[model samples]
Target: MADLKVNIGHLALKNPVMTASGTFGYGLEFADFIPLDGLGGFIVKGTTLKAREGNDYPRMAETPSGMLNCVGLQNKGVDYFCQHIYPQLKDINTNVIVNVSGSSPDDYAECASRIDALDNIPAIELNISCPNVKDGGMAFGVTCAGAESVVKAVRERYHKTLIVKLSPNVTNIADIARACEAQGADSVSLINTLMGMAIDIEKRRPVLSIGTGGLSGPAVKPVALRMVWQVARAVKIPVVGLGGIMNAHDAIEFLMAGATAIEIGTANFIDPSVTIKVRDGIDRWLDDHGCHSVREIIGCLD
Candidate 1:
């Protein structure tokens, strides 16, 4: 069998297949469908310092080959995760990483610090790039200074494997990635849902309640691949690629584009079993190519 082990900073994944945050819920929700232990890692929903009700109705709308979501960062706050969610997750066999988000630098730091206290949680995916929320989400992700500020603050308080997710709605994504790296980001996940929107022709209004939403699906794969390639080249840390990955072939495309690993997002909504399928597909492809491990193809693009 091909060696599937891959590392994101100090956190090692069995394979280069992980589930995108928000899309996979808290990992426990999908327990009935796919084996959580079989995954490289599963990032939970975006947790904030305080509970957020998120946006209004019609938060999600289906588009051609993709979908738009303005779900915001609706969660019950970090305290709830620690009190209720952590106990159930701490015993899980696989890597249980939290997707941390906040409205301020202090918020991010406090939430991360709390999660760090949990002995079972090994890593965190900082969500300074979410487009769904209005106040903070992607605000800290567009500029280098902004990205560095949030990362720098969290890096001080949170001493775990920190993977900062980057936004695609920027002029120079590579610069943003480098800024995060310089500020002590262990790894960088790219192309976090491109900014997009749709209008209802009849009502002559926007389909989403928030007026705009984050787009994800096969449609954004090419753009995602391009950004992943650029960021991967710009930073020494691992790049977790996700935007519109649907199947194993799409995941492989990301791997060749310089992503150390690929995260399944919209694909999860299509097939709950798609992540496992992608994992198996990657393993089979490696064996077919006579590659002993996934590391051989980490940045094999030519």
Candidate 2:
């Protein structure tokens, strides 16, 4: 079998396949059908300093080849997550990276502070992009200065691995990656969910009540691959690429393009065991190529 271990700053993952935020809930939800401990790490839903009611109905819309969501970082507060969620995941033999969302720098810091102090939670993925919210989120991730400011403040309080997830709705994604790196980000996750929308022609109204939402799935793969390659070259730390990754080959493409790791999002919705299949497929591909170490494929696009 091919070795699939990879590192994101100080955190070491068993493999390069991680689930995307919001899609996996708190990792506990998928523990039965999918083995959470078998994968690299599971990125839990977006947690805020306080509970969120989310937006109105029609928050999710299915597109031609993808889906749009305005989940609005809905979740129980950080304290609830630590007190209730963390304890359950402690028994699992894998890292549980919490995906955090907040409206202000102080909110981010406080949430980070609570999670960072926890023993079970190993990393924190700050969700910088989510178009379906009222307060902060993608608003701070699209701009370089905004990304830097948020990352910097969180870095001050969070001691564990800090992975700043970035939005694709930017002119220069490389600049945004660099901004997070400069602010002490241990790693970065790209292409959170592209801002998009779908209209109900029959009803003559927007499919989503929010009118617009973040898009994900196969349709965004090529665009996400390009962004991943660009940001991988720009940043010094590892980059976790996620946007339309469906199969093992798709994950391999991201790795070749420069992603140290890849996250399976909408694909999980279609097939619950997709991540393991991806892991198995990658192993087969590596063995066929006579490559024993998965690291050999990273940035091998030359």
List where candidate 1 sits over 4 angstroms from the true fold. 130-138
Question: Largest lDDT belongs to which candidate?
Answer: 1
lDDT of each: 0.90, 0.88
Per-residue lDDT for 204-237 in model 2, tens only? 9998988999899999999999999999988889
* Candidate 2 C-alpha error for residue 102, in Å: 0.6
At residue 128, candidate 1 shows an lDDT of 82
Residue 165's lDDT within candidate 1 is: 95
Q: For candidate 1, give the lDDT.
A: 0.90
lDDT of 1 by residue, 194-302 (tens): 8899999999999999899999999898999999999889999889999898888899889988998889988889899999999999999999999999888887988
TM-score, per-candidate, Cα-based: 0.97, 0.96
